[model samples]
Target chain A: EAGVAQSPRYKIIEKRQSVAFWCNPISGHATLYWYQQILGQGPKLLIQFQNNGVVDDSQLPKDRFSAERLKGVDSTLKIQPAKLEDSAVYLCASSSTGGGGETQYFGPGTRLLVL
Target chain B: AQSVSQHNHHVILSEAASLELGCNYSYGGTVNLFWYVQYPGQHLQLLLKYFSGDPLVKGIKGFEAEFIKSKFSFNLRKPSVQWSDTAEYFCAVNAFRGNTPLVFGKGTRLSVIA
Candidate 1:
């Protein structure tokens, strides 16, 4: 089975500019996640979706970040008025289900550099 | 808030050397643990996971982790290292309570010399 797929492996933008990243998860997967990975740090969950419904997004910077899953298939993460601190890798991952003990597979991630 | 701690920031070892990386979490309640590895130019993938049952769990690439409930630790290990084992390893934890996102620690970068 194909793994998770992400677009624009790298991106650059100025502070206050807007940026968006796309993700297409493995077929039949029910859980999709967006994470931010700062240099030297592990990926941190920004949002999670289960079949088009948000499962968790407590850590998401609501004032600047937003994400959506379309028809429970594809997902997009957007950051408006991006800040320099937002310069980091954005990774997408998916699992067969949101149930217990399910393993998640990840994508190559989009590395964003905000000036 | 739940948090994870990876004691080692970087580790260097020669091939055939024993390996051990420490991981600890803050939450005391029921929790799930995982170890993920990211090779250069690759995505983060599961190395192993601990849900319940046996505290010792074996994962891909000859990696294993032992969960110590009393210590709130889940440490990764390998009997022997290889050049192929060079990667960034991350330890993550998720609480069993309400919808909680998995929290990860600053990763440990492992470099293995052949």
Candidate 2:
């Protein structure tokens, strides 16, 4: 089985510009997630979706960031008016279930560089 | 809020040397622990995980981690390090609350020189 897939492995945008990242999770996976990983730091959860319903997005920046997992198979994370601080790798991961011990699979990630 | 912490930012050792990377988490309730490794130019992959039962959990590539509930720690170790073991290691925690996302630590970069 193929792993999670993401588009545009790298991206560059100017401050205040808008950027979006796409993710296609593994087949039959029921949960999808978007995470922001700053350089030298761990991946931070931005949003999580179980199927088409959002499970958690408390840490998401409502003012500038948004994500959607329509149809429950693919997801897109968008950042408007991107700031220099938003220049980080945007990762997409998927899991089979929301169980405590379930392992998550990650994509290659889109590395964004905001100038 | 739950958070994970990795004590070492970077580690270096010669091939065949022993390796140990410390990971600590702050959570009062029952939780699951995992160790992930990201090789150069590769995506993150699970090395091992601990949910219950044995404190010592073995994973792929001869990697193992010991989960200490009282200490709130899950430390990764390898008896003998290989050059291929050079990668970034991340520790994550997931609480029993089914829908919660896994909280990850900053990560540790390990370099094994031949």
Candidate 3:
């Protein structure tokens, strides 16, 4: 089976501009997630969805960032008025279930560079 | 809030040398631990995971990790390392209850010189 897929392997935007990233998860996967990884840091969870329903998004920046997993197969994460601090690798992952130990498959992340 | 910590930021060793990377988390309740590896120009992949049972868990590519519940630690190890083993390793944790997202530690970059 194919792994998770993401669009625009790299992106560049100016500060205060808006950017959006897309993710298409593995087939039959029930859970999808969006994470932000700054340089030299681990991936930080931005939002998680279990079949079109948000499971957790407490860490998401409500003022600037938003994500949606409509129809439970694909997802999109958007950041408006992007700041320099928002420059990072946007990773998307998918899993089969919500249970622990379920392996999560990741995509080749979209590396964003905000100038 | 749950958090994961990786002690080493970077490490370098000759091929065939032993390898060990330390990871610790701050959480009182039960957890699921995982070690992920990201090779250069590649996406992240699961090296191994520990949910319950044996403390020592073996993964692909001769990688293994020992989970210590009392110490709240999970350290990845390899008996003999190769140049291909050079990659960034990340430690992550997820709580058993609720809809807690997986918490990841700052990764360790390993360089194995031939």
Error of 3 at A82 (Å): 0.8
lDDT scores of the candidates, listed in order? 0.92, 0.94, 0.94
Total clashing pairs for each candidate: 0, 0, 0
Candidate 3 off by > 4 Å = none
Give lDDT tens digits, candidate 3, residues B1-114. 889999999999999999999999998799999999999999999999998899999999999999988899999999999999999999999986555668899999999999
lDDT of 1 by residue, B43-82 (tens): 8988999998999999998999999999999999999999
Report model 3's interface C-alpha RMSD after superposition on the true interface residues.
1.4
Please rank every candidate by lDDT, starting with the best: 2, 3, 1
Clashing pairs for model 3 are none
Better of 1 and 2 by DockQ: 2
Q: TM-score for each prediction?
A: 0.96, 0.98, 0.98
- Measured against the true chain A, the candidates' chain A TM-scores are 0.98, 0.98, 0.98
Question: Model 1: runs farther than 4 Å from truth?
Answer: B97-99
lDDT of 3 at A14: 99
Per-residue lDDT of model 2, residues B57-87, tens digit only:
9999999999988899999999999999999
DockQ of prediction 3: 0.71
